[model samples]
Target: MTQSGFDTDRPVRLGVQLAPQHHDSYQVIRDAVSRLEDMGVDILFNWDHFFPLSGDPDGTHFEGWSMLAAWAEQTERVEFAALVNCNSYRNADLQADMARTIDHISKKGGETGRFIFGTGSGWFERDYTEYGYEFGTAGQRLDALAEALPRIESRWAQLNPEPTRDIPILIGGAGEQKTLRLVARHADIWHSFVSPDELPHKLEVLSRWADKEQRDTSTLVLSNELGRRDEAEARKLHDAGVRLFTHGVSGPDIDFDSVQRWLDWRDGING
Candidate 1:
């Protein structure tokens, strides 16, 4: 269970993307948040989209930011965020305002808040078309995202009391030209959907960009979504320098066993 390139001394962090598109989303998310936090998960995330990515195309999906506010109120120990919020869905300043509000909610008690502002360029064409947003080309969307990042960060500062803390930005995507560059400039955490074999090259590219920018690449956390349920494979990923792991499952019957296995792996790695 030894993780290569990772500091075994540092506590391993496990995260889950609670699909908000299935069953009674409001209640399911509430219950899952409580259960996962109690089960010792480090982070909980929900996807930001209007329609279900899986299951019925027009399933019972819920809005991301509102659900997050509820999670901030309900959970105490686990950090919460959207796996990657769609920047095209909301205005940049407004997105920052929503995050700041959630940060305040999570920190209502004596303890500090835990909300990572994970976001990216919008991709689901259905979401944009149905919601009246202009479904621009991929390049155009990336351009918008690049412009929005700074405004989102700046607005967080202008908000009263600032944020509960420095809200960590987690950008999702592995596109070499746009996504990796954006990650180097803005993200505290970079999430890629590819397998481990593809990761080393991307990491190297990011490192090169970081070097050019005079930024400390080590501070940017490398994260990836596990595609299969093999602990050995997950371990291999850990050995290759991916510290944060995420997996997706549809709702109604969430594969809790899958979640437990990941949690167990995280615990064993840290121990």
Candidate 2:
């Protein structure tokens, strides 16, 4: 196993984020889920938000956790979760319980389980304003997340049936001081939005925090956005220690062309 938490001998993995917005119906999202799974994508993700992040502000959108519950029962082989769950929307204990429930729900035909608890401090102020959540400052939200994570873990330990498996906690953020510190302390996977050129520096900062926390960050999986970046660009990120590449596709017309390209790229590398 490498220091990046990803096994160097294992195959590279591809993930697709089916943004649950601009879709006229749930059936569209459901079909995309099935197709992505059948295509052998490693993980599926949806964002935790109340409205659309792009295009029209009030466009057709679905709630994240509920859709995830439906996805749990709908898919058989693929792991799924919010690309980054909003930590401020729900109680920390409730979030833990919800993730545990989804973990069990996703198990099928003797399969262990498939749930990654990807979360971050809440952003998208519109989600807060319209939903009645307090839109606190960024630092305040990060502090809340720092305090809540341990409680979430504690609640998971106390849950009745327990999770089918140890749910992997994925924290998404690139904030050097607090976010990376929390990642060192709790996350099994750390996701960032930075480009290939910016990753090494961030990793260095993360390593410093890991040393301070006495945590082996080398075992932490590194993730980056797979957005319009071509295969060549992706290889640079891979060389920088990123193993999981995720592409976010918006709805109404969920295109798989880019996803297919990345999957092909992943296969070429793995082979």
- Across 19-108, the per-residue lDDT of candidate 1 in tens digits comes to 887777477767777888898878899989988998799778888888899999898878889988999988999999999889889985
Considering every candidate listed, which one attains the maximal TM-score?
2
- Worst window of 10 by summed lDDT in candidate 1: 1-10
Q: Each model's C-alpha lDDT?
A: 0.83, 0.89
Model 2: what TM-score?
A: 0.96
For model 1 the TM-score comes to: 0.94
**Residue pairs clashing, model 2:** 3-218, 4-218, 5-219
lDDT per residue for candidate 2 within 116-166, as digits (tens), equals 999999899999998899988999999999999999999989999898887
Worst 10 residues of 2 by lDDT: 1-10
User: Which structure among the candidates has the greatest lDDT?
Assistant: 2
Question: How big is the positional error of residue 241 in model 1, measured in Å on the Cα after superposition?
Answer: 1.1
